[model samples]
Target chain A: MNIHIIGGGAVGLFFAAQWCEKHAVTLWTRTEQQAEMISRGGIRVLENHMENIYPVNSKKIESLYVEGDLVVVAVKQYHMKEVLPLLQNAAAQSVLFLQNGMSHLDFLEQVPHPHLYAASVEHGLAKIDGRTIQVNGRNKTNIGSLRSGTAGIIDQLQTGSFRFDWNENSYHMLIEKMAANAIINPLTALLKVKNGEIAENARFRAIAKDLSREFASVFSYKTAEDTFQSVLSICTKTADNESSMLKDMKAGNLTEIDAIVGVLLKTAEKNHRSVPAFQLLYNMIKGKENTPEFMSK
Target chain B: MNIHIIGGGAVGLFFAAQWCEKHAVTLWTRTEQQAEMISRGGIRVLENHMENIYPVNSKKIESLYVEGDLVVVAVKQYHMKEVLPLLQNAAAQSVLFLQNGMSHLDFLEQVPHPHLYAASVEHGLAKIDGRTIQVNGRNKTNIGSLRSGTAGIIDQLQTGSFRFDWNENSYHMLIEKMAANAIINPLTALLKVKNGEIAENARFRAIAKDLSREFASVFSYKTAEDTFQSVLSICTKTADNESSMLKDMKAGNLTEIDAIVGVLLKTAEKNHRSVPAFQLLYNMIKGKENTPEFMSK
Candidate 1:
């Protein structure tokens, strides 16, 4: 099987390294420098106190599209617009998206791809520079079918080190994952605490309970308590990790707050529910994104 | 007229220094050390390029209550419980309460004093030590009669450097002031920003407007928009000052969270309205107060 992975970020590099073992994988990067570096040195992955590099073909995004059996679009939701055209033009048999938040679900309706799928990655991976990567805890990458007749593709892609779990209801899966993201991300960012504090810190936990209950009332099919419990579980599992949003804030980078909280705010509005916590967190994160120093002493 | 100013904080010391120049002022301190310090060196007040120290009578809390004509109670709402018995047994003709929140309004009924008044200080003040104080922007102290026969007391206190503005509707004036405190204090403390940033920062301003509007709808006599406008005006006026709550958080001291937001939360509950932003800010501040390092990275 031949696969094309888009974007040179952590998720992109992780999938490229994992799938290249059994599949003919070509990593597509935004810059020729990254493509050349990866092509020359291979994708270096550090795990279990071991350093290993996987050799894979690579090309810049602007280069001629290499027709592959599968194309994995692993980019931030905001970058979806730029890469959507590339995915549309690619002659891949199936296109799978691995982006956080449900924002991309809306734009997927416009895509002409025959086999479409979306996934929430549980395994936290970090891409160091163009080629180096570190994979934490071998958590399952939950994948769900957005378009029919794509169950076969899900089966074919299951044979890899990157664990893939199939969910019949993709929307619910994304919502649950998003509830975790929306609750944990902005809070850890704004409060500047590690992920565990969301659950361990009594005061933060109280607010998290309110936010989770409010969020589930408007968005979740699961009961508010269930959703809140799941959020606490995630915090405990990733206790030591600084949330991506917090890191983004420290580096003064634009966060995926729009994709996470912005989508929640819009859904709450459509549902005619007043979610003040969601609204406040959304506005606070957006403000922090524009000026990191604004919220600081 | 003889005046007794209870409490030795910045506000108490400022009032003692200002009023002692005109009226015979006696300051009461919780600690005998503070009383001895003030009694020996006088209350030093820094204002308008002038360092003025006024000699005044001072005593510890357990000392016999002086038979002054007017007693200005300048303690925090939390300490009101401890000092209520003191105020009740005092020989003063009128007892005036100058606290930040509306919490004391409930217990003011228990005070057996002949006349009662409550005030909200507009002037920003800081106690340098047991005796030294800094007074910023000599804004008028708005006083209102909490009980009958207090109009005369407001008039009598008007002779001092601490300008007193008498309002017929004192509850309304306190609510307006509490609204400002509710909107400004927790935000500055949580976000670690100056008072001005609440109005100047676009993201913070958006949250502030929403919070203000939500708060006014449940508590204020003024419309939500009108209340929010007043909050903005306040942010502009005291842009440089560090809110007392923020200072308390920095100093790792217990804040008046229960007095300010706790009272508001109870009001919201009684009104059967949900205030998520208020609840969240309250919990976060309480969490911060308990562990100042909890919210920080």
Candidate 2:
């Protein structure tokens, strides 16, 4: 099988490295430096279970053929607008998105893609010191086809990369994952605290629960309670993993708070749900994110 | 004038130091060490405008003379229940409370003694390093009798110690002070931010306004707008000051959140006004205060 990976971030590089052992894989990266590094040396995956850097082909997407059996879109949600259009030849192929949230629904609806597989991953992977990569744990990863006819795509990807599953109720799974993300991610980021801090605080829990309730209302499901419990479990599972949101905030980078929390809030507004707690949380985080140092201090 | 000051915290020591300049003053304290400090070396008040260690007699009040020219009770609200009997002597003559929030109402209802002056303070004084006191800024002090025929008391105190004013409407003044304390104190404390943070974040201002609205509804007054504006002014005046509530939270001591926020919220319930934000803030602070580090961290 021939595979083309878009966006040479952690997930993209990880998947390329994993599949290159059995299949011909080409990672489409934007930078000449990264492309040259991967073309010369496959990919370095410092996995918790195994540690090694294998060689693979990496090239600029414009110079390589996009007509592949599978194309993995691993770009940030904000970057998907530009990157999605670049995969013109792979419109008929199954595209697996290994990103965090489902903010690409508008793009998904607009584009006539043949098959789509959405995944919500709790894997602790980080590009260490900008040169190497490290996977702290073999965390749970869920993947499923959005369309009913493409169940086989989910089956084919079940080969030993990480744990992946198929669900008839894939939308519920996405919303559940989304609810958890909205609650934990922004708070961990805003507070500059670990994932465990949310569970440790009843106020934080209440705020998270309220926000989840708003999301559940929009999705027409009551999953916040279960999802909140799952969040606590994830805290214990990945206790040492600094959440992406937290890292973004610490680095003074703009967090994907809009994709994770803002989307849920907008959806709730569209659904006409009253979410005062979430509204307060949203306002607080937005203020913290936009606040100047003098005012904040 | 002969005066006796109870509770050797910032406010008590604050008024004691001021009143001792011209009058015979005694500071009653619980901690023998603090009592000894005041008795031997005198009370040191280092104000931005002035600095002095004025000598004053210090002792524990097992009992007191039933007659005095003036007395100021400045204990915390929670301690008021146990200390009311102790104030019986002072209540017979002339008594002024220089404490935060509407905590004095409980004592006023139970013991309706004549010649009572319920005062509200915005003076920014704090005990910096146990022995040393720091006055951050000058804020007006308001004093008035809860009942009639105490104009002389208000006038006498206003003429001397501090920048004082007499309000004919003392209940309204109490409510106004309650509104200010309810708004400014808890937010600065719980958010672990300075006073200016409230003005910087509009959400905190909204919460402050909501709390004030709740107070207005219960007390049948229209001080919400004025009180909120005053709070913003305070945010500027004490931009660098850590509020008493914040100080208490940092010290792991019980915050006056109850006296400031809780009392107002309870009043809101009595008047059938829903104070969602204030109730939420109160619950969070109370929960954090009661729970141990294991539960909250």
Candidate 3:
């Protein structure tokens, strides 16, 4: 199967390197320099203290013809709107979205593709350079169709190092990941602590509980205790990992606060439920993003 | 007038230095070393970029006879419970309670003194050393009786460098100050930023607005905007000052989170109002306080 990944970020490069091992894969990067570097040097993958470079086709996003069996949209959610139109005109047989947060659910509904898949990538990936990617942790990627059954491209992509699971309910999978991001991302960013610190610190644990209750209310979870435990477990599992939001803050880059927490706040307002914790976290992340240092970048 | 100031911390030492100028004053500190230092070298006051050392009498808290005309309780709210029994047995005609939160209101009601006054110290003060204090800013100290008219000690305290205002409604003044502390203290401590950063930063300002609204709801303020403006002004006025709570966090000491935000949360619960912001901030501050580093200290 011919696969085209629509982002050159860590997620995009990681998947392209894995899928290119067994299938025809091409990476589309926004910058010509990154595309030229990857095309000449190949995509580098560092896992378990070992480095392997995979030869794959690379092209600038603007020059892409978008004719492939599967096109995976792996860009940040904040960049989704600008990239959506390009995907709409693509002649791909199926499109897969691997973005975080539920904000993209609205955009998914409007897609004209016959076979549309939304995925939650749980794998930990970091971009070492323009063409090199580091695999911090290998985890399963949850994928489900928005309007149809599992796409045939999944079987081709789910070979070797690329692992994919078919989620029965795409919304449920997306919401679950969204809930975790909503709680973990902004908090880890705001506290300037690792993911595990939220659960390790008692006071921060209490906050995690309160935030879980608020999420339970908006998501209609059966009990807040269950939600809190799920969040705590995630914190323990990713204890040492600095959250993507925190990394964004440190890099002086804009975070996906609007897509994650902003969506929840709007839902809370519509439900006439008060979620002050989410409100504060959202404002703080937004404030940090708006600071002079971040704005200049 | 003979004034007895309890607690040899910054506020205690500050008032001791100011009151000793016109009135016979005695400072009671928990340690004999601090007391001996003050007794030997006198209390130094740095105001207006000038230093003045005033000769003052100092005694250890254990040796306190409590036989002064006016007993000024200038300790932290956390220390109030342990020292309250001593103040109850004191031979002072009247007692003045200067505390940060509304939690001390209950303790003030239990005092046997005929004239009971609770004053909010608005002045910015920092302890240079055990025997020296620097006045960051001189603001009016609002003093009023919890149940009666203006206490006679107000007249004595109103003179000299110590400015005091007769607050007709002590509860009102206390609530106003508590609201500001509720917003400023935990945020500054948790963010590890100065007081002015709260107002200068847009994101933190949004948080200040939300916190102010929650406080206004519990305290029955006319509007959240007015309360938010008042809190912002306090941030501006003391821009360079590190809040006592923030200072406590930096020093790895326990803060008065319970006295300040704890009271507001309890009040909100009693009123059947939700305050997630305060609950989170309280938990964060309490969590930082309960850390191993802070606990060992």
Give the root-mean-square deviation of each candidate in angstroms. 2.9, 4.4, 3.4
- Write one digit per residue (lDDT tens) for candidate 2, span A174-221: 777777777777666545456776776777676556555556667776
lDDT of each: 0.84, 0.70, 0.84
Better of 1 and 2 by TM-score: 1
Better of 1 and 2 by lDDT: 1
lDDT of 2: 0.70
The sequence of per-residue lDDT tens digits that candidate 1 reaches over residues A1-297 is 888999898888888888887889988899999999999999999888889989989899974356877788887888888888777788877778888899998888777768888889887666667889887656788888888635556566766566677888999999999999999999988888888988998889998899888888788588889888999999998887777788788778889999998988888889998889888888777766855664344
Cα lDDT of model 2 by residue, B229-267, tens digit? 877877888888888877776677887887778787778
Question: Largest TM-score belongs to which candidate?
Answer: 1
> For model 2, what is the alpha-carbon lDDT of residue A257?
73
lDDT of 1 at A284: 73
TM-score, one value per model: 0.91, 0.82, 0.90
Each model's fnat?
A: 0.65, 0.10, 0.67
Off by over 4 Å in 1: A31-60, A126-136, A154-161, A294-297, B31-64, B127-130, B159-161, B294-296
Judged by DockQ relative to the true structure, which candidate is superior, 1 or 3?
1
Model 1 lDDT per residue over B239-260, tens place: 9888989888877788988888
For model 3, the DockQ equals: 0.42
